[model samples]
Target: MAPACQGVAVAEALSIGVNYGQIANNLPSPARVSWLLRSMRISKVKLYDADPNVLRAFLGTGVEFVVGIGNEAVPSMTSPAAAQAWLQQHVVPHLLSGARISCVTVGNEVFKGNDTALQAAVLPAMVSVHRALSALGLQGRVNVTTAHSLDIMGPSFPPSSGAFHPAALGHLRPFLAFLSATRSPFLINCYPYFAYKEDPARVPLEYVLFQPNAGVADPRTGLRYDNMLYAQVDAVYAAIQALGYTDVEVKVSETGWPSRGDPDEPGATPEYAGTYIRNLLQRIEMKQGTPLRPATPVDVYVFALFNENLKPGPASERNYGLFYPDGTPVYNVGLHGYLPPMLVSNAARQ
Candidate 1:
């Protein structure tokens, strides 16, 4: 068993999910992170890979997980034997230990890139993984899905008139069918921060930050959207509905603002990041839903748990984390964690 860490008490019951990316060389050990998350009352975590160390760390913690298979592994999942072997090795052992893994995302943003082969293999890979789960009698308990980039949408402004890009239509049609048949959700990485950064002049900071503003009205639906995140989500719902898929639920797989960025990157500061996350937490605590799906509460996983130093991209890309590697808050959004000193050495070895 992993050594126990000190747990800091948090007041609010964490209603939001957070992405636990491990792209950094300087991250705390999974055991330590588990304690931190538990301390903060964050019950749900999304991992980009089925890292055994992480799955093992959370055993019996009752913290639910959404583990993933990376893009490079997508092609291999097309083979039934390969999929079964992968799952049995990486996932089953943890499940047997009482790990609460609710979903398996086959690939992350496979459609966003220009890789046509990866796009073609996505659905087949998902089907194979789902079949493997069924063979093991874990189908319904563990849903199989993949995350998509917002680039898949053609026109997303008027939420009611949202539609998928024509280039993506061919792949999405069958993908939606698979989701509907399996009763799984459509995971989307919606980044309002990207929109604001792209056109800060035109995009109101208040709108994206969930601050008070006049808000925008969808000309067709007549629904008022006070926040761009909700508008983006509703637009996705509209796009999904347009493709004759009303059954598949929409979930935000990733969303967050960066605490720091290059000079060119607008609205990227500690203040803006804290405001965005704090306000988002408030809305989530109230169980607020998108205008389109008012009854079905919006499911969102914040972009990252720790600022990754190794990620290759714009400065903002590596600055989305809410905490530093030492478990210190990058900017206080009312969340706190306790990283045991004993685990600090363990984390360094990793």
Candidate 2:
């Protein structure tokens, strides 16, 4: 077993989850990361893929996981044999060892891409995965769903006027039906940072960063929204309600501010990033919910645990991490983690 970070213990527990993305080569081993997460008192984690090393590392740690089946693998999940095989290999082993696997996301942001074939396969894949889970008697225990990009929504302003893009409606109708029938949550990646970056001249940084501002009032419902995150979430709720489904829940699958960016990427500073996370954490700690669903607390997973050096795209893409690879925090958001020393091969043998 890998050693735990020395002198590290649980601090103030936050109900928020963090995304454990591993699109980098320099990241600490999963065993070491397990200790880091525990030290920070983060009980929930979201992975873009069902990585066995991570699952095995967190076994018996009492951390709940939301694992994903990648986009390329979605089509194959339509086959019962394929889906069952996947669960047996990647998920079942860890579950038997006491790892809490609460949800399985069949695909990530399928509609955002231009691939029509992938868009059509997403729902079928989810159905097959859900069926396989039922066959294995793990249906109610593990909810099957998919995460969507905010681009799936048509007009997200006014909150009450929110609707899914007509191009995506055909796929989303059945998608919402599946979520409603199975009592699963609709997961969306909400990035208020993007809005500010896209239109810094017009968009108010205070609104997006959860800072104190006059706030915007939705003209239709007259609901006051102080933060863009809540507005985005409420818009999603409205979109789902428009589809004639109110039984489904909506959760933020990924949301974070980049601490750095290119020349063109605005509002990607450490200060803004820290403020966004800190303020969001404060609200989440208060058990706050969106304007549309006042009774339901907003469920969110901050996007990325560590800076990924190998990630492709803009500079900001690689800078969303809350921590550096060595476990040092990128900014002080009241979160501290310790990456245990790497285990040598000889140590493993011992």
Candidate 3:
């Protein structure tokens, strides 16, 4: 067991959210995480699941949450009874405990592949959940939505012309209507690092890193974008607008740079990660929205508070954490936090 988090404070409330991923053999208790989050004044958090212990730990803490239902459960969620049962079991208990459940994500990145059944079930599951929320009088208070990987877009370059792949539109059109009608936000996980890494020759390092660079112009909109993040966001806006739904909102549910990566993974250093987060935090603090929607402030959630060793993929997949499991900073973001001292095991006494 790790000691309860203590001795961390910042100047203002953190509108920024930090992901709480626990795919590791070792992790601090939810009680300790509560202290850590409160110490930093983080008012929002996104979880891959609705862990009862975690929900219990954050009771009455005023920390809004966006919880998810795994991909395997998407098909089951299409059944209204299953959806209501899952909500009653996993969600209602939390609400009963006074947990501030802000959003329920039906499935994550389900459109990234050819799983037509799962893909088709995405919107239905979201509908079931939204209807369930409405039945329970939680429609406006607890929004139902899903997150998508940037891969869903056909041509992300020159962002203003962005469009969903033809294959995804069958699912996206109805999905957009559901979101617009329910007044929920569309969540997208945008990673500019993936773009720069795949085409270093064409994608300038400075542009993706949020460093000073001569950015490209959108020939269509003539909107000057100096950073790739904003460009990616605006592209999504354009795609949504093209769908004939101009009233829906888009939010970045996941975005972060890794502090470490394999030799082949270019530009994944602590310095660059620090720069990306610092610059992003500055922009967010300014309440800066996309170039297309300057009046609406961009809502973002930074990925992974602690790196997970068990995450399978490229080295970068496990290295996006802002902090290590032992509660050490991966890189300074002008804020310092403390994790309680780790408890020792008897086996290590040898």
What is the Cα-based TM-score of model 2? 0.95
Q: Which pairs of residues clash in candidate 3, taking residues 3 or more apart in a chain or in different chains?
A: none
Going through the candidates in the order shown, the clash numbers are 0, 0, 0
* Tens digit per residue, CA lDDT, model 2, 269-347: 9999999999999999999988888889999999989999999999999999999998899999998776667765225
Stretches off by above 4 angstroms in model 3 are 1-11, 342-350
lDDT (0 to 1) per candidate: 0.90, 0.90, 0.84
- Reference-based lDDT, residue 192, model 2: 98
Off by over 4 Å in 2: 1-12, 343-350
Q: Kindly report which residue stretches of model 1 are placed more than 4 angstroms away from their true locations once superposed.
A: 1-12, 343-350
Per-model TM values vs. the true structure: 0.95, 0.95, 0.93
Higher-scoring candidate on TM-score, 2 or 3? 2
Candidate 2, overall lDDT?
A: 0.90
